[model samples]
Target: MAIGGNPVFRGKNFRSAVATAPPVPQAPYGQNPYGQYGQPAGQSGYGQNPYGQNPYGQPSAQPQGQQMTPEQLDQMYKAPSAGPVETGRMTYDDVIMKTLACLGLVVLGAGVTLFVSPAASLGLMVLGAIGGLILALVNSFKREPSPALILAYAALEGLFLGGLTRIIDAFAPGAGFQAVLGTVVVAGVTLALYKSGKVRATPGLAKFFLIAIVGYLAFSLVNLGLVLFGVVDSPWGMRGIEIMGIPLGVIVGLFAVVLAAIALIFDFNSIEEGVRAGAPRRFAWTAAFGLTVTLVWLYTEILRLIAIFNSND
Candidate 1:
């Protein structure tokens, strides 16, 4: 007797048969309902979407530079899809570590310059400026950060800064230390202001800062030309010229300290973005490089400021 129609034997036999027979198919394990295949799952379908859609269920992308949804365009234009956005791994400790490394190089180069020839130091300085500039441009444009290049830039800038410090120190023994202290104070205060939102990097401020920087650059070029042509006998050429008994260098240097402080704010902003965007660990070096550049600029200006003040006094 069959299980449906019979009694004792029927139930037992039917149960055994049902148990022995292959199990009726289940939705293929983890198979997508919209998938193309009726095939039992655990198999790839046309377009390879398991659940009748892409892995992430995103529709295939259109051509590049074409119109896209706001979200899509943002994804395309923003930093590459490396990982989740991050924030605040860049602490004062990180900055200090990097700054210490840069300063070590500064010390090394300065030691050499002090014991060796100024010409040797000057030659190295020119080399450093050139090398640092090239690497800076290269790193800025790269899709990924390069630690080697970044560290190289640091070393090069250190050589240049150290050599220049020695030259100026010949005239002013404690000026290097003074400039260093001044740079630290300026950077510290600027960072505090930026972090506290006391000194915001508003768009208007950025625009003004850019204009000032460009003007400073133009003035520097003119002054350099004047010095090279023997038109100016002063140490800083036209930059050292006096207006109302005040060296023009003093005014320019003040503006530069301010500019460099603003630049530090920009560096902070960039590092904030990089960390927030989950940029790679190596990018820490990029942050370090930028900080180094700003500090160097700050120190140079501070040194000049002191010199002008002393000369005037």
Candidate 2:
């Protein structure tokens, strides 16, 4: 019942139910005919009455009206049925719908920032980046998923992405579009591989992913520090350093892209497990949130990589 690898899915909310036999109901005192409370053997007050009438003084066992016909019973049986939510189970449709909702909000937020003035968009982007990061961390560590917070994170990330795209595209026109196309391609390919069983979130691969993520985070933090301290004149800090006549950013970006793809695999695996385990329908939001985080990361990395290539040209 344990969910591992994905921080967003590591809570009891996603655990599977344990099956056990139902306890047998015991009879009340003096109700048992077999000598309970001095009751006589083979003597009982109960009797089978089809009309639900008491054997004690009361109305006759037969009802006044005639019973419904088989046609009526058939009509009742043909009525529209309740859905999965009504039955209290998570379903693929639920996950897909919620995921689409989150993505839609992201697109809406991005569209707003995309058309705004540069100065205003920059300010919003800064606010969005900081806010998104906080919310993302909050949602990840939360025991239960919050729909409001997850949507908020998506909107903030969109704002950040839109502004970043605007700024980067100014320096290198069409780079943003290329990045979008690249993100789509990567996601599609990753999904294909996952569905085809060519890629999987095996334990060893998951461990490797964790190590790589930690190293990448450390490097990114150090690079950010160098850039802020004016130790690296390049906008990308050490990533702008050339190796074999190619910017180091390309290498790192490609590596990061692979990691992001693998992260998608993990997300897919978690979702599949959740569905198979009959996790609560509410956890569909968690699955959506996880996919959003990985996708945003994937898009940003592709955007940066494309931007660097354009800058070099």
Best by TM-score: 2
**All candidates' lDDT scores?**
0.64, 0.79
On lDDT, the leading prediction is: 2
> Residues 155-200, candidate 1, lDDT per residue (tens digit)?
7877777788877778777888898889889988988897998876
Candidate 2 wrong stretches, greater than 4 Å: 1-5, 11-83
Predicted candidate 2 versus true structure: per-residue lDDT over 139-239, tens digit per residue: 98777779999999999998999889889989999987898899889989999998999988888888888899899999999999999999989999999
What's the residue-level lDDT of 36 in candidate 2?
28
**TM-score on alpha carbons, each prediction:** 0.67, 0.78
